[model samples]
Target: MPENRISRAKLTTDIVLAGVFGLMSLPFALMGNWADLVAMALFVSALAVRRLAPAWSLGIAWCAATVQMAALRDLQFYDFAVLGVLYSTAAHGGRLVKWLGLVSAGVGALIATVYLQVLMPIFGDTSGLTPENLIAAAFILVASLALLVLAWTAGLLARSVREGREVRRREEVANRERALVEYRYTVEQERNRIARDMHDVVAHSLAVVIAQADGARFAAKTRPDAASEALQTISGVARGALGDVRVLLAELRHREGGAPQPVLDDLGELIEGVVAAGLDVRRVETGEPCELGTGHQIAVYRIVQEALTNALRHGDPGAPVEVRFDWTPTGVSLMIANRLADAAGGPGTTATGATATGPTGARHGITGMRERAQLVGGTLSAEPGGDGVFRVVASIPAQPRSTA
Candidate 1:
């Protein structure tokens, strides 16, 4: 019923106040009579326990009230302790105890009126109570009931305010926790997006550079001019890769673009660059040109780029690679294929021809390609076929035609 935690300092202060109230009431009880002395003692005891045990405080105040009635005395100053106990019962006690405080106020008023106005004087000096005495008794009953009920109501109101504040504090804490979880989920999605981007850029560039390095190595003795060209191609590919890596790093710092995203229009230069590195890449096109959103164009470009890059990395260097595009009103279809291994033996090496090799620990190429396709409302599959060949097929759906 009391506050949940009371510091040692606060306990000491309350004890001192209780002692002072008792000492102040001591003289009035001594001068009035033995019965007043007993009533004051019980009322002061109720004050001492009011906060620590509010229901018990109320019970003790009722005992003091009964003692005052039996003593047949006028109300003493110490009887004010009943108001303090009534306040505590509502402020600190449970529901049952709070109702008991209100009941005590009504019942105590009735008992005190009858004893003081009618019984006390008839036994002592008055032969009987007059009409004026009865009226005074009614006034005393109303006044005492008002003060006691006011004290209890004040306690109930204070309790309501404290409970409201506690509820608001808990809601604020829950909101903060929900916001933190959403923030973490958003950060995780962004990180996965960046990882896919890095894989596409770095893997495609490495595949081109490796093919060029192989060309330069195999051509150095017999064809000096061819070797020089291969070196030039390698240099260009490396520079592009470096620039792309710089752009990705800048993205980590939340900077705007430092490199342009590849689009379908860039496919020609992309195919030409691969062919220059010694892979025989043939291009085929059908149907009329169609407009596409930037996101769809990027997906188309990257799918072709990654397919060709895989042919250079994992297919025979002298193998013929074919890329075809079929555009319709609804969507575009794409296919890319290359020999998986040289006719002579092993992967990437041709019979009577040279081999191209590069770093080979990546498996995210297909995943990155599939993610790109999905972003454009499309599908893609890359697989090896029965004739020692690898193939890629992709279907990219188009958006509604824009008139603007």
Candidate 2:
């Protein structure tokens, strides 16, 4: 692509140079006088090399033509060559070159008209205009005006094309960057879906198994029959949890509609699983319950689950976590807070809590949580609490875009 671009640039430069010099050589090439043959030869040769040296080619062509007119001692019809040089310089050269080329052309025309009409006639009638003069003058004037307009218009068009190409290149780069951002977003969303499913399955399953094991351990000597029943319940809960996990894993892998989508109603089961783990939770609700869209409900459920999980990880086991939901006039607000138990801190060691401990709390996890919230036009915060408590708070706007 780079080589091709360089080649095209060279070709465009050659075309511009050729057009400029072709005009410069126009007047000398039009003459039929035998003495003008040498000048015409020089002009033609310069035209061939114009692409290599435009200014030199144009200047040499104009000078040779002027010299030939001087030698003939007849400047008649030479004004056309000067006009051609002026147009060429204006189209291809810089501001100074354009001004000088035009001034020289205008002066040359005035001098040629004077010499051809007055001075040259002292030797002989070399005016070359009489019966044919009016028609020749009209043709030259019209042609020069037309060529000048054409060259200026062509230069404008070339500039516009260059600008348009540059704009398109920039837009193409921007589009590619936008596509990459969207792809990364999709991947992250899918990964979050998988992670939420894993937490739902594993955490709940472990809770039930641990509860049964604790019960079995306590009852092993005195209530052997109750211990066997607890073991049976463990088997039942494990099978059920495994089935749920299998369905979730299948959905995560996108195995052709493996499970029905879970919504707000399914949150009760999630809460029950944590309760079965012997964690004390108090859930308070406000406003009449209404069916929410699956995606919104899923976002809500995940936010709540994450908050509760953090509570379990950081709060003392004996402390109760409070879960509150309020559907306000503007949006929904969810808050989870748990008081820390004094026993959680070892002697001379302060309980820093999970928020300060691991990657999930300090690094990528909170960032991911915030991302999920923002994706649904919501806001989330995790902060230290005075009086030995930690809080997780989130607010999700109702009719998301309406708030925006």
Candidate 3:
């Protein structure tokens, strides 16, 4: 049999019953009514263990019934313990035990009738009953059986009602849990949308400004004319970056609507901006361009944008950042790699020049990149190499929208 767990409330109820009914038995015990005293103990045991061990409670009640009949003790008010036992049996017992309780009810009524009519006359004072009083004895027997059946049947009905209530309560709790889960999912979706917009605006624009500033420094040494041209590029790029940051900030202040996302067509402008800032960077593209959906295109653009941004912030300025794309009919594969900066850090300066977690540590930049990949039905992993190279690789799956 499986073990049934009982709650603290139920155990407390059993303890209370044992105390109340155990004390109630004292009156009978003092009167020298051994049968009533014994019945009291059995009935209290039934009440206490009804939920915990219903079968055992039923057996104890039956033994109490036998003692009362065998002693031919006159029925006392405490004899109501029989009805309490019968009710508990139906309410709490298993299938076999409930049926046994019903049978015990019938047998107990028979024994009660026999004791009142036959055994009392032989052992104790008969009072008014005699062998000649056939009609009276018959009436008594019928009424006793009726009350016994009523007690047992009442318990069965009560059990059915209690079980129905329990079933309804459980369903209510399940519905509440499902609603909570759906609400959390909706909140998460909205947060991700806001995050994607902010990442695109901040990371891409700053990468270009940093690249231009670096180039101006290098050109200032060799050619004054070239240095002047680099300075102009830096001024224009910084204004554009500032404008993008303002737009993202506005979107953050009012979350009801969203700003436009970027796409693959923007890649050239993004890379050129990086080159103007002055990093040694190269771009490689292979295979015919496959048409990607807006969401997938945004994912591809943002991932590349973030990778390039990180490269400028953490890569050695003298080393080249290789951005490569291997496009196929089904998907686009991207790889970006550059030599990681030594403990000295990169030569680029940004609006937020905080690179404490640069190439080797944790940063929000990596998290945003990974989220973008997942949004596009892809996987991304960026790892720092033992050989001082940091590489980010991603594969984004897409199907031609005409087929979709």
Candidate 4:
């Protein structure tokens, strides 16, 4: 509900409570008991502001009680409004007012005992301090104190329940915000991984198909056998690209992980495929291979795949591409280099092995390779060497396979 409406509703309820008590005390005004009627009016006013202004309500109740004691008026039904004021002090009052309510409960009980039992009997009955009357007065004092203190305690219990509910609600909202942040982070990581896979599969295959298609078109009239071989390579590369794309699509449809990915063991087939498309590749390995986790292996495979694809698309067709792997006890380092085509052999080439407008236009291939290396706690750099050769180098640390 709107705040103003809620406030108005609370005011209405308090008014109804005050009206009911005022009607019950109407006999005081009808019987010409003016002092009692004035005390009742103060108590009714206190009840009306009990929730809306608890401190004011408490002050007003004290005034009414003082007037009744001063006038020596007997107890009336409207006096019960004191308990409601005490309750509101704890339930709605600020810290200072809440403690004051407790003090009022104790002090008001003591005052009532003195006024009713000690003073009233001396004035009305001319009674001396008898033992039996003293015992009865002591019992009334304890009962009156308990009643006032119980009302204040009930209000305190209500305050505790309300505070507890507010604490739980705040905790629930914080948990939801934390969950949303974690979910977004997971989704972004997954998207980057998928983008890397798509680039590796599509870019590499298309480069091979373009190379074989060009060669087939040129040699179709002169050498039919060479043309037939080129067609076969193109067909195989296209089919493999199609299968990889389908697997990626399937992974998107179902979130249960992806198909088996290429690893270090698959490097031979990768090199052979490019060689069939008419680029000479020389691969050399040194030292012993270290074990690596599945995620690290994927990073390595994609980095090498993207590097080779960049070379096949931008390197000189007549020159050989050199690939080397140096393995140590801790990690493996890779280097792939190829002579740049005549058009790319310029001083204006950027550090990413590309010109202002190099092959694979936006250079997402190099950026993706760098991101993949970083994901596996590795590093990569691609730049043109002083000898007019474009080199892609990467270093990856070994990690234990996960059992889960």
Instruction: Kindly list the per-residue Cα lDDT of model 3 for residues 1-404, writing each as its tens digit.
Output: 31235787996898697668778766775585667778767777766776677777778777876777777777765567677678867877788888988998888777777777767776776565575655656777788788877888888999999999999989989999999888778666766766665666666666666666666688788987887887788678778767777776776566554666677899898888777666677999999878888888878888888787777876777889999999998888999887766623345322223345543322577777788888778999887666667788998897555454
Residues forming the 10-long window of minimal summed lDDT in candidate 2: 1-10
TM-score of each: 0.73, 0.62, 0.58, 0.87
For all predictions, the C-alpha RMSD in Å is: 5.5, 6.8, 7.6, 3.3
| Candidate 4: regions farther than 4 A off | 1-11, 17-32, 122-134, 253-256, 347-349, 359-362
lDDT of each: 0.79, 0.61, 0.74, 0.85
Instruction: Indicate the TM-score of model 2.
Output: 0.62
What residue runs in model 3 are displaced by over 4 Å at the alpha carbon? 1-81, 93-100, 117-150, 160-205, 213-260, 265-269, 275-288, 291-295, 311-326, 335-358, 361-393, 400-404
Candidate 2 vs candidate 4, lDDT winner: 4
Candidate 4 has its poorest 10 consecutive residues by lDDT at: 1-10
Per-residue lDDT tens digits of candidate 4, residues 1-404?
A: 11112278889999998989899877854564777888899999998988888888889899999988887777788888888989988887888889999999999998998888777777766575567767878988899899999999988889899889989999999999999888878777776677679878999999899999999999999999999999999999999999998888787666556599888889889999999989899999999998999888888888888888888877788999999899998898999898877544567455555655664542889889889899889999987787879888999999987889
Evaluation by TM-score, superior candidate among 1 and 3: 1
**Tens-digit lDDT track for model 2 on 24-73?**
64565465565455565555444443333446545776676666766653
> If both were scored by TM-score, which would come out higher, candidate 2 or candidate 3?
2
The C-alpha stretches of model 2 lying farther than 4 A from their native spots are 1-57, 73-139, 143-262, 289-296, 339-344, 347-352, 355-371, 374-389, 400-404
Could you tell me which residue pairs clash in candidate 3?
211-277, 211-278, 212-276, 212-277
